[model samples]
Target: MSEQLITPWAESRPLPPYKGVLAVDAKDFTGLPAVLHAPVSQMIPELVDQAMARAGLTSVLQDKRFPANTGDGIVFGFDPAHLPFVIWPFLKELDEVLAQYNLSVGPRIRLRASVHVGPLPDEGRPDDGNGTPRNDTHRLLDSRPVKAVLASSSEQTTHLAAILSDRVYEDVVLGGYAGLHPDRCIEVPATVEGKPFAQRAWLFIPSPSGNLFRAGVLAAEAPGGPAEPADAPAQRSGRSYRGNTQNVREGTAVMGDVSGNVSHTSGDTRYTATNQHWGSGDNVSGTKNTAAPGEQR
Candidate 1:
């Protein structure tokens, strides 16, 4: 080798192998008393084992599984082949496992999870599953959409909310390998805090819990929030939000805390109309709204 060309590929750098990345985070984990941290953290593996068994993928984490602890959660990598199973029975089973566990625990554990599939580098450390996919997994877990789903739901019923990368949604759910119904997934954006990462992702809730309302999945959700899917109404039966019972168009009564404005009227009303008599006890006025005689008009 008297002379050698300094070409880019001359020094072969092998590509990292593709892996299925999963991140599960416990909501308000730090809010729990310090004495419970170790016990709660120890239960994670048990929860995953139960979930894996229920999904019939007992070997999903058998070997080379790198689990990184984030104090309140874990980020792990496994064979991509098991991803479909993870999405299917695994997620639902995890929800059930948490629910069953919650029945006995004083401070229940609720989770936000994300799933992604891509090339992942061998970790520098045992728990450090390195690569962009790992980063993506955690970002999706921290995304606003997924957080909103959990925030909007009653803490008692909804045990988990998850975000799936578009790749996983297309490859596993859409490809029908996982038996997971595509309709159960909601489209949302994944954005990382103070980072330039943003992408389309799919959201899944094992149980909608008490998050449902007339026209929104989250309370005070912006107009740009997720569009209500066509079949959503049928799923709202027997669900309650906050302390209020949802009765659809029949009527709804909310007695819990409201962070936003609530308005209603019995007569034909225009939010921007002036000098119009609209029947209402509590209503929002965007413009000039006439009131009862002797009252502020």
Candidate 2:
């Protein structure tokens, strides 16, 4: 006989409806001194509550539906219709909240948020929000594109780095419903470490930080502490060179069919982008005969 496809409890409950999912996690939470961990962890929800109040999302918080904490962060599952609200006022309000908190508090608080929409069956949902959508939500939150946005930026200036699923990006941002501008978002590959997951996603940063800021007098204070040249290569998404190719950002990173080594000056490390897909393949040691992926140097 074939194995049962329907579980006993699931058969009785009506199908769960698709829902909007949003998650926020602190950057470098583990880097804090152990003593400050408790106070910091305790503030995640309180700050969220304050943001909700500002976004007028207090009703959902009152319902306390699908709220889960992932040690250093929190997740909220809600009706898909509210996704736009979460994307706009909620995210903006949260960014403001974090900026204020970091200014007045010790152990600066920076965050990475992910927005997704999917079903969370009543009975089958994991206790800590481990459904596929929420899992993907976390994967996006942990993805390097988003992390690089935060990492490459100044923690004091950059408050939040948010990732959006292609669906949400289309339905909310591109649909002209979100306060987030379309041009501000960059497409990226959303993947997880040690996990079988890959998808195209979008990234948004509310405030400019480090190397991502627009060029101007402010550029001088950006990550590298200097303004970039007018002829610098345009920023590319995901890994470098569009393949296993090395992107020579030192002078010219123009894409080509041939493989070559790349080098940079002392301060040029700021321009050298680390490939999130297969790790950094930059040949900065000033040597010939670089090894290919998985080969001994």
Candidate 3:
């Protein structure tokens, strides 16, 4: 007999809306695929499992309620209420584990992850049918700001660069639950094709010393002297973002595109994209996907 579909919280049963969505990607995945892909491909799932366990949330994996799948990376959902306990711990452990794995192996393993809170498909519903907040979370991962953090930190002691949407930062992180301070968050814009001002998120780098949310800790520990200011605009090839300079770089890094690569420079690694401008605006066009969240009974 065919196996029955096991729906967590029940099929068509009222369920609480997903409080947040998290997306992760291996850095420079295509750059050194020959050397890194095989090992990275093998370790991602193990890291995910360990991270979930570290957060004391192995049930989310067993029950299949979280719907986390790893391809080149991973994406998962969790209750916003668990932000302090669940997601933070997961990232903390994941960072350490990835560091350990990289040390044990030859090549370094780094990740770019994003977190956003919004409505998502209800339990038992199909995610592929709509773009949902989950996709938005992925878009944030592709944003230049996030890539900038990851790229610039390539030569540093940091291994993970995480971006939190403004909503998540303002609501949860700033609310004082995760022990993450507001000053550590660097604001940046995210623009998607056809979507103006499509991206706006905050970036945070996890430190090797285990102080995940402390600003400047990673830079201090980095081999290179003090890096860019925590709040400096993402610096691209020939330009930067500041006041009304208009001398900004524009680019688009489509989500899930294997061809995309992060460009590295002597000062800071530049983000690869179709355009080079990183300006402020909500004037761009194009609609993204979102799901009508469900309420738990």
The local lDDT score (0 to 100) that residue 261 gets in candidate 1 is 38
Best by lDDT: 1
Give lDDT tens digits, candidate 2, residues 215-250.
Answer: 110223335443334443465222233222332222
Clashing pairs in 1: none
lDDT of 3 by residue, 56-107 (tens): 8766656434555565687766666666654377777778777776776466
lDDT of 1 by residue, 1-297 (tens): 555644776688777788898889899888899999988887876787788888888687576368767878777788899988899889999999999989983679898989999987765655356667888888889876688668767878889998999999999999999878776776654555466676778888888764454324433223665353343334443322332233322112232222233333435431221121111111122332233344321
Q: After superposing candidate 1, which stretches have Cα over 4 Å from the reference?
A: 1-12, 123-128, 213-215, 218-297
Off by over 4 Å in 3: 1-16, 34-39, 63-70, 192-197, 208-297
TM-score of 1: 0.68
Candidate 3 at residue 103, lDDT?
Answer: 76
Model 2: lDDT of residue 85 = 82
TM-score of every candidate relative to the true structure: 0.68, 0.69, 0.61
